[model samples]
Structures are given as C-alpha cells and as structure tokens.
Target chain A: MVEKKGLSYWLSHAGLILGVIVIGFPIWLAFVASTVTQSEIVSPPMPLLPGGEFITNYKEALFSGINAPVALMLLNSTIMALGIALGKIFISLLSAFAIVYFRFPGRQLFFWMIFLTLMLPIEVRIVPSYGVVAQFGMLNSYSGLIFPLIASATATFLFRQFFLTIPNELTEAARVDGAGPVRFFFDIILPMSKTNIAALFVILFIYGWNQFLWPLLITTDPSMNTIVMGIKQMFPSGDDNANWPVIMATSLLAMVPPVLIVIFMQKFFVRGLIESEK
Target chain B: MRRTVIFKGWKLPILLLLPQLTITALFFFYPAGQAIWESLFIPDPFGLKSQFVGTGNFEFLLSDRYYRNSFRTTAVFSISVTFLSMGIALYLAVLADRLIKGAGIYSSLLIWPYAVAPAIAGVLWLFMFNTRVGVVSWYIGLLGYDWNHVLNQGEAMGLVVLASSWGRISYNFLFFLAGLQAIPKSVIEAAAIDGAKFWRRFRTIVIPLLSPITFFLLVVNIVYAFFETFGVIHTITSGGPQQATTTLVYKVFSDGFVGQDLGSSAAQSVILLFVVGLLTVIQFKFIERKVHY
Candidate 1:
C-alpha cells in the first residue's frame, strides 16, 4: 500500500513537471529567437541558447520605417491605452453607482441593454464601425481610436457586481446628511470599491494596449498607428526574405508595456481574477 | 411629493448612463445598423454608389463556394480549439490544485502567455515557424517533413490552432483553478474518508460542482476562437495557402477592407451576429440551467 501510494505521488509530480515544460518551452523559444541572428535560427541544429545579434537586431527594429518610428508608435500606444483606461473606469463607476444607489424608471431595461453589449463581439461590427469613424472625420486620429473603446460593457458589469457588494447603509447615511448622489458616490462608494477599480484599470489598460484590428482598419496614417500595427508592418506580407531579427526585435518592443504592467500590478491582477469569480 | 422625489432620483441614473449610452449608440448600434443596411445593397467601390439589391448579397453568399468553406472552417476551428484547450486546461488545473508547494509560481508561469497581445503572440509564433529562420521548421525538417505553413493548408490551420490554443490556455487554467478552489475541502475529505478513489471523487464531487465555471469557460472560449483569432490569422497566414485558413471574421475583414465588398461583408456580419446570438441564447437556456449555482 505504501509503495502504491508513493508511485501515484511520483506519477502526479512527473506529469506536472512535463506540463510546466510544455507551457514554458514556447516562451523560452521566443526569447531565444529574439536574441539570435537569422542564420543561427534556421541552422540545421537550432541554437539552444541566446545568440549574439541582440543589439544590432534591436537597433534595426527601432529605426526601421516599415511602419512609423518604433518610439512614436510606442508613444501613440501609451496615450491611447491611458486614455481608454481612464475613460472606461470613470464611465463604469458612474454607471454602476447610478444603477446600485438610485431607483429610477427603465433602470433594469437600460442595465440589460448595456449588459447585452458584452455579448456583441467587435468583429461583427468592424466594417460599419470603420464607416462610422470615417463619417465622423475622426479617421487616422487618436480620438477615434480611444472613443470607440471607452464604453466597455465588461467594465460596467464588473463594477456593478463590485458595487452591489458594498453596504448600502453607508450611502443611506450620506443621503440623510444631505449628500447629493455624486458626492455620496465619490466619498463613499468609490473608496469602498478601490480593489475592483484597480483590477479593472489594469485589465482595461492591457486590452487597450493590445488592440489591433479596429485600429489597423480605421487609422490609415502610419503616424497614428499603435505598437501592434507597427509590429505587423515590420514584416510586409509575401516577403519571403524579410528580416526576422528586426521582426523579433519589434515584437519584443511591442510586448514591453503589457509585460511591465502585468509584472508590476501582478498582485492586483490576480486579485481581480480571483475576486471576479466571487 | 412622490413625483418630485421620483424625478430627483432619476437625475443620477440618467447622468450615469449618459456617456455610455451615447458612445454605444454612436460606435456600436449605429455601425451595426449601418452594416445591416449595407448588406442589402451592392456598392461600386470606385464610384462609392450603392444600389439596393434586397437579399441579393445573402443569396450570393449562400451560393458561394468560398463562403461555404469559410463557414465550415470557422465552425471546425472554433469547436476543435475550444474543446482541445479547455480539456487540457481542466487537466492542468486539477493537477496544479493538488500540488503541495510552489502553486503560486506554477499559476503565474502558466499565465505569462496571456499578458502578450494576440498580435504579438502571432508574431512570436510566426518567428518560430518561418520556413527560412523558424526553429520549428528546422525541427520539422529534421523529422523529415517539408513543413511550410505559408504554402500548406493543413499546416496553416494547425499553426493557427496551435497559436490560438497556446494563447488561450492560460485564461481557462485561471478560471478552472478558481473553480477548483471554490469546491469545499470538507466534502472532498468526506469522500476520501469514504474510501472513494481520486477518479470517483473528481467525477462525483468536483466535476458536478465546477460545471457552471466549465460552462462559462466553454461559451467564452468558443466566442474567442470564433472572433478573437482574426489578428493571429491575419498576421501569421493572412488566410492563405489557397484560402484554407480564412475563417468567417477574416472573410469579413478581407471582403470589406481588401476586396472592398462592403455590402457582402455586411451581409456576412449580420449572419455571424445572428448565428452567435442564437447559439448564446440556446447555451444559456439549456446549459446554464444545469449549473449548480
């Protein structure tokens, strides 16, 4: 019995080790590919460790005008991401507060309408959305990119869920003390839901930074392109002999912001996922 | 007094919903409605003049060989990827849950891929799969297979599936892990005390309890596989190798953006929306009811 139990334990441990390797190998390969020169990557026996072309690859990637300059693209991505994050958080907070703290006609109907949008994938509306942005004369502009993404049904849903869990007595007390709805929400509700807000902020920031298709279709001018579009433009379609080193380098640069955000806000990120489950 | 109080209460709700409503109307509903309207009219790209054809676009799509293949490709890809990734994720989540140490490290490491955007992830995969410089190509050649995703349809589909699954597994793992943690320890302990084996305990207790999360993840994973793969497909394959990898969304983007067939693209969009909406309603109605919570 002891031997059988020991065997099962070892089997489970071995399976886990294998699983980790399977998950980790691709990421390791990505990093390795980024470091190596093009020839080393395609060599008969692929280089198992970092190669020597890191700096040269990165410099070429940064300076290449395949898209906008890499630095400018990064800057555009940052502004767009920050704008959308702030806009989404503020809008969601207000929407959640009204729904939770106030009683009004058609409230349920309005809430459901917004909730249903969460089910509507952006792909279905890409063409018409492109037309709308074009019609508004906001094409190739940051406002066009940011405005469409600012109203997030998922953020509102998350905030509403979090707000519903806050004690109503505090808001009632504020109201009795002659506090207006805005004042009550700002002073009481927002403070109580800080964790949820932080989590949503990080999530939305990542989403906005990583956005590709809509921005690609809507923004015609390379100057307004985000990091994602820049990375894509690095390797022109049907170019068999495209520079792999530069492509990898640009991809690495595009990956920087989200990786930093995730690593820095790792605590809030995990908390957000765990809390959302509840 | 009642009327005055009611009016005052409404002011807050109205203010809160105003920005969201306006944005949604302008960006989402208006565009969607326009797309639906455009689907009924064929347009000349050079002239930008549209003429109403009334179901002509839909009829053309229904009869088109390319459209039929794209529909099949999307259905097969979404279903296959969702099941494969979700199945593996559940297994990994169960394994990780049973670990006595380094659970946090395991969890965080598993989630690393999710941090990268789909476009970035596609580039990373493309870097590793390029016929000239790709490490995977080197390995494939070593194994005696002439594998170029660019030229081969089957390889292209496989690469897309592989990339999508690799990117998606982390989310499923996270959700499943959460669901596993939610199951009460005492119930598992009781089952153990009753001499129930691991498989039995999992089948009778854990599976039933985690069904809701599983179902939620299923719906989400399906939706993602259908819509979210556009970036990856566009980047890696560009719906190439004789249009073998062109899923429905890719077709929409190509037809509308590249082919400049806005009317047909809009018709396709309406069909996709209807199909997804119907599926979602059916899923919720049937599967959600079976959920314990």
Candidate 2:
C-alpha cells in the first residue's frame, strides 16, 4: 500500500518468493535425497522429487547408523538440550533475582565475573576447557556435556535486563507484606518471569541442540554423541561411498526439533534473540 | 547495575550467585587462565614435562608460513561469509517489508535454516557439492567445469563459505526485518512525497537509518565466522586439501586435538581470546548507542 499499483510491488513479491525457494532448495534436496535409495544418490543427478525408500532409509538410520544408532544420539541430544536450557534458565533466574533484588558485598564483582564469560565462547578456549573437564574426570559424562556449556552470560544478562524493568513498587509491596526475600522471589518474581523464561527456554534449547565442537570433544563414545554431532560420524570413514540416503535422513532428524521450535515459537524466539543481544 | 529497592541479606545473595559463579570459575575463568599459562609452556613428546617457553610458541606461529596463511584464509573467509549472508538477508528483508501479507509465511519458510546446526548445514551443502554424487556438481560439470572441492583448494574454501553464509542468512534476515520494520514509515513517506524513487529512498533513507543494525551485524557476523564455524569447516574441509580452509578456530581444534600440540594451540587460543574480546567491546559499544535511540 505504500506504493499502489506499481510493478515494483510485484517484483518485490517475486524476489521474496525466489529468496524463499533459494533458501529452502538445499534442505528440500537433502530431504529428497533422504527419501531416495543409496544407489540412486550415488549414481549422480539424483531425482529431485520424493522416492519410495523414505521409510526404510529412516528406519535403518534410526535403528542402526554408521557408528551408533540415530535413536540413541537423539536421546543424548534431548538430554543435552533440556539440560542446557533448564540449567541456564534456572541459574540465570537466580543470579538475576539476586542482582536485581539484593544488595550485597561482591555483587558487582560477581556481575563482572559473569560478564567476562560473554567474550569467552567455547571455541576460543577449547583446549583448556577440555583440560579442565578431563581433569575433573567428567569427560564422557552428561555433566561434562552440559555443565561447561551452562555458564551462559547472555542468559544471565537477558534475565537481568528483564528483571530491571520490573516495577520497584512490586518489590516494596512484597517487603511490606512481611515477605522475606525468598518468599517475595517465589511468589512474585518467578510468576512474573514466565514469558521470559519460556522465550529463553526456546532460544537456549536451540542453542544447546546445535552445539557441535564441545559435544564432539567431550563425548568420545559414539553412543554418547548428540545427533547434531552424530551426523558427522555417519559420514564414510575415507573416500568410500557415504551412505547418503541414511546420512541425509539423520541430517533431517538432527534438524527437526530445533527447526520446529523456531518455526512454532517464532514470536518467542525472535523476542528472545533480540533481547538477549541487548 | 544495582537496584535501589533491594533485599538486604548478603548470605542469600551469595548463595543465589554460587552456581553461576562456580561454573564460571571452573569452566570459564580457570580454563581461560590455563590457556594463558599453558601458552608459555611446551610439552615434551613423551608427556613427561612441559618446558617453559617465553613467547616461543607465539614466535613460532607468527613465523610459520601455514599459520600466517591461516590468518589470510580467515580474513577472506569471514569477510565473504559476512557480507554475502548480510547482503542476501537485507535484500530479502526489504522485499518482505514491502509485502502486506504472506510476510509471515515467507519468514517461516526461510528462517528454519537458522535452527539447523552449522555442521548439518555443512553436510547439506557438502552433499550438493559432492563431486561424485552431487546434483549441483553435476550441473556445474555440464557447464564445462570440473567442480571438485576435494582436490581444489579454492573450491573447498568457496564451498565452506557458501555453507556458513547460507545458515546465517536467516539470522541476519530476522534482525534486518526487525530493523526494517522499525524504520519510521513517516520518513519514507516524506521521501516519497519529495519524488525520491524506491531505490533512491532505500539507498539513502533506509540504509542510513539501518546502519546501526548493519554495524551490529557486521561485528556479530565476524565473530560468528571467526569462532562459530568450526563445525562447517570441520565437516566439510577439515582444514583442506592443502590447509587452505584453516581458520584460526579450526587450526586450534586440529592442532590441539589432532596434533596434540598444547603449547601452540593454547597460544592460538589466547590470540583468539583477544579477538573475541575486541569484538565483544565493539558489540557492546554499538548496543550502548542503540539504547540511546
């Protein structure tokens, strides 16, 4: 409506449509590859449309993949995703509640310490972080997979930002009503943070699910692999023919949960992403 | 950062912060400190002892031809990936902003790629460019080119860049769309009344207004390509046919994990630390400015 009856509008729509198709074509082709037979995929120029082997390919991949079964990896991925999301949210909420509602010695110190973690992503500190985890005898455990990734400054920062926007009167009224700090937090802050918590849950869940290097390093056992990392394991060892159909099937499976979250919870995800950056 | 209306218990506040602080100390600070300390020590082959090296590892890496090339490789890789992804996303966002309906539909269709892990994104693109079986590779072959990323360093770098950029498009699109929608309709309408055509208005008014977001994204994307693309590089190039695709992050992983050169890897990690610290500061500076808006 900004410009009425213009060819530009049609062109805009056409460009967007083309963008969508281009954005989507790779995955669509991957999905098509997943449904086809391996022979068809290996032969070159695989069919663009769906094939008849979808069920068998998915079945084989899920039941028994190249190294470990996809089903097991899926379970590991679920645990990691849930563990990171809930763990980050719970701890972040507590930290934010303390920083916002309590005045104590070393509060600023603690805040800066947390802020420091924001710059230190796992990629930069992989060697030493791996050493720390290994020294703790935590390698190959679920805690190893989850705990190191849980100290997310962004989540704490986002929670702190959200809590800062809460009205002072709410805290004052809670104190006036003879509520201790704990009670006030339980009855007031927790309930108020429901939407924020949900938004963060969606974002953190995806972040956790999509982690690659940490899980690859920590989980030496193939059975312990998260599906995201496990997909790489499914590739052929050498120049041999990769089980493209099965690998493609696992790729789609590795993506489905997080993609569903982003698509279905688009509003929360968008809000969380923007707010977290702020 | 402190709230004026606050609870008064030091014990409870300390208790509340304990978990985060503990994990930070154990996983974050301690590791980071170890990285710095370990950068000064080179271990023996038998793992018996680490000899103290005062900046020897850094000197070695700085002089090494491959290490120097990795810096160049990373520079080109990150710049290409950041600009290509942002450019496409901005184009799509502008188009989406113009449409009154189906914007949501188009966004949903387009953005699911964001949730796909970088490794998975690599796999998807690798399959399409797999010389033996790839449909795209076959198409390129028909165009009189032998498209093989396996033996070709340039093709390998381009493939990883494409994979990394492809997944990032949705992220940039979402932000760009938000930024586009945030632009005041009144300013654009005023420009239209001034007889500025669509491209001119977009070029001048919309882009300048979008600069904050663009700057923020540039820093973010550089950080992303610097660190977050380990998976893409790992799955696809594995630092290459001739180490042509080895970014610093990939080099750190391969050297530390594969080569088990803790001293050099720790040295690289420390370098990456400064890079991230710089990016974090730039990002925060922009966020501060954005708050003023």
Q: Which prediction has the highest TM-score against the true structure?
A: 2
Tens digits of per-residue lDDT for model 1, B204-293: 999999988887787778888888888888889889888899999899999888888888999999998887788668665754465334
Clash-forming residue pairs, model 1: none
What's candidate 1's DockQ score? 0.51
**Per-residue C-alpha lDDT of model 1 across residues A1-278, encoded as one tens digit per residue:** 11133666667667767877887676677666668887765454567787887787777667654666777888889999998988988888888777766688989988887876765678778888888888999998989999888754878877876766665566567767787766766787778888888987888888889898988887778888898867777675665566666666777788778877777788888777655433
| lDDT of each residue in A158-262, candidate 2, tens digit only | 888888888877777887889988788889889999989989999899999999999999999998999999988877778799999999999999999999999
Docking quality tier of model 1: medium
| TM-score of each prediction | 0.92, 0.98
lDDT at residue A1 of model 1 (Cα atoms): 17
Binned by DockQ into CAPRI classes (incorrect, acceptable, medium, high), candidate 2 is high
